[model samples]
Target: MEAAIRASQAQLFEAQAQLTKSQADWERAQNLMQANSLTQPDFDSAKLALATAQGKVKEAEQQVRVNNGKLTESKANVLAARARVDQSQGQVDASVAQENRSQAGVDSARSRTVGARSNVEQANVALGDIFLKAPMDGVILTRSVEVGAQVGPGTVGFAMADTHHVLVTFGVPDILVRDLKLGQRLDIKCEALPGRTFEGTVRTVAPEADADSRVYKVEVRVDNSKDVLKVGMIASLDLVDKEDSPRSIIAVPLGALMPNKDQEDAYQVYVIKDNKAKLRDVTVGRASGDMMEITSGLEEGEQIVVEGGNRVNDGQTVKVKS
Candidate 1:
């Protein structure tokens, strides 16, 4: 489950980065075409790239929903398995007590006790099979069974995918593969999503190159919890030669930040202070997908307005939507 979650997260982030880039490129092309600086073919290409990026973003969002449902199902199955194990243990204990009380029917009682113990072992095995753990955390792309459906050995009930963290596989030149290593973080960009960049970890480097292509298959894992990246999105990968330390910051969705009318180039968020809208100017930092990092304006644990902010004024009484 963890692995599936990671893969999905990676795919989402990668897709989001690509979408941001593509949107920027498309906008630039639009401006250039209006100025008569860009050729018709170039502008058309940019327009197409933007559309593709939009599609990818939608696909990534769908994958996140599917993966979340599968995670919930798997957790429920684990709980059921534990219950079955406990029930089997109880049966074994009851059988032993019955055997101890029957002196005249010793042989018969002994046979029943042995059978009960065997059933307990079989139940344990069945319980183990019920776990349905994914190799890596991911969405269940296909589910082949319904509730209460009969299943047996070799029955495939569902297809599990790890999209939260996803493997981006691409062919790299044989020479380039030699310089790659496991656990190394790489910078990647998607042509469809033009201006945005994402980070990926080098998970696997194929030992052999394809005979015809003369390129080795390299797989990079990305985190996509932000729901920006998608599986099968085309990406350009590059090694990040230098590593930078990570930073933690409080951030909110872009919808939570509203334009400040009084001050240009400034933003405000309507925080619910004492059950009233307390609008305050905020400093913003880097934007990723739908989230903007709060640099200095908002504090942690404060509720910010996400919807219907325009309907209220500063210090206006407001009720939260159910």
Candidate 2:
């Protein structure tokens, strides 16, 4: 379209040049006719040439206008198409961000226990027997060392696991570790026990990511009083932040919100900072009645202008009413 406009403009310039030359020629012909030097046929031909040049100039100007109009329409269509692409990309990004993030792994305990009777029997032959007791009550799963094989410290005597309250451990990416906290609930599901969902509480979260996997380890403790979950069983964990057990959401009264004139489809509010009302841009989320959820740009315990917002201006000193 731009190329067409340029071509039309070039044609218009050429037509204007021709019109100038024709006018000069017609003037010379008129003077010659009055001085009786030029013939009537030649004078009539000059007049006709002048009129034809004028018509060509008008035609070129019209073509240039038409081409310019088409160019503007084409530009508008391009802008509309780009806007649609941007909107689609934004929706895709939001969906990815909103997706429930979780991780899964197979875990089993490995701590050992030594029987007191076996330790006493070996005490007569050896220099005092050392009895190893497990901290928790559970069944011993494996006994690695034989009886009196000259065992020392750090030897795996017997591996035991607490069945009454099993622990499910997994590793998650760095992004998920931030949201996880102690005592947070997670849904644990074992393949062996179908149609059963056990509630688990977060027991531990590794402070740093593992060097090899680049993920943080998280342990969840679940109630297994029914003895349904066994050792070496695989279980999948679902991080729970559902509506029934919703996480705390920061919100403000609807009256505090004000339109952001500089940006489209954006909002702002005046927050009381240091006894001054300061304008702040905030990303809003789902609204509930008189309260509006703020996804970003606001923190808990920060005071805001919930009433008479129109009277407040940004950076204006304000007094709090007791």
Best by TM-score: 1
- Cα-based TM-score, every candidate: 0.35, 0.31
- Please provide, for model 1 over 1-322, each residue's C-alpha lDDT reduced to its tens digit, 9 standing for 90 to 100: 5455566677788889999999999999999999999989789989999889888777777767666776776666556655655665665556657856545455554555566566556655654554356567566678797544678889898887766777787666544566789998888776557788889999998889765445577888888887677765656655322343566779887667777887644678999987899988877554455566677878888887887677668898887765
Cα error of candidate 2 at position 220, Å: 0.3
lDDT of 2 by residue, 1-322 (tens): 5555676688799999999999999999999999999978789989999999999899889877766665665555556555555555554455456546221111111010123233333433232122344678787799696433677688788888779998886656555577889999877777567677889999999998766445577889989898888886756654432333557989887668887988644679999989999999987654444466687899998988888888777899999887
Count of steric clashes across candidates, in order: 43, 1
Cand. 2 Cα-lDDT? 0.72
Candidate 1 residue runs with Cα over 4 Å from true position: 98-322
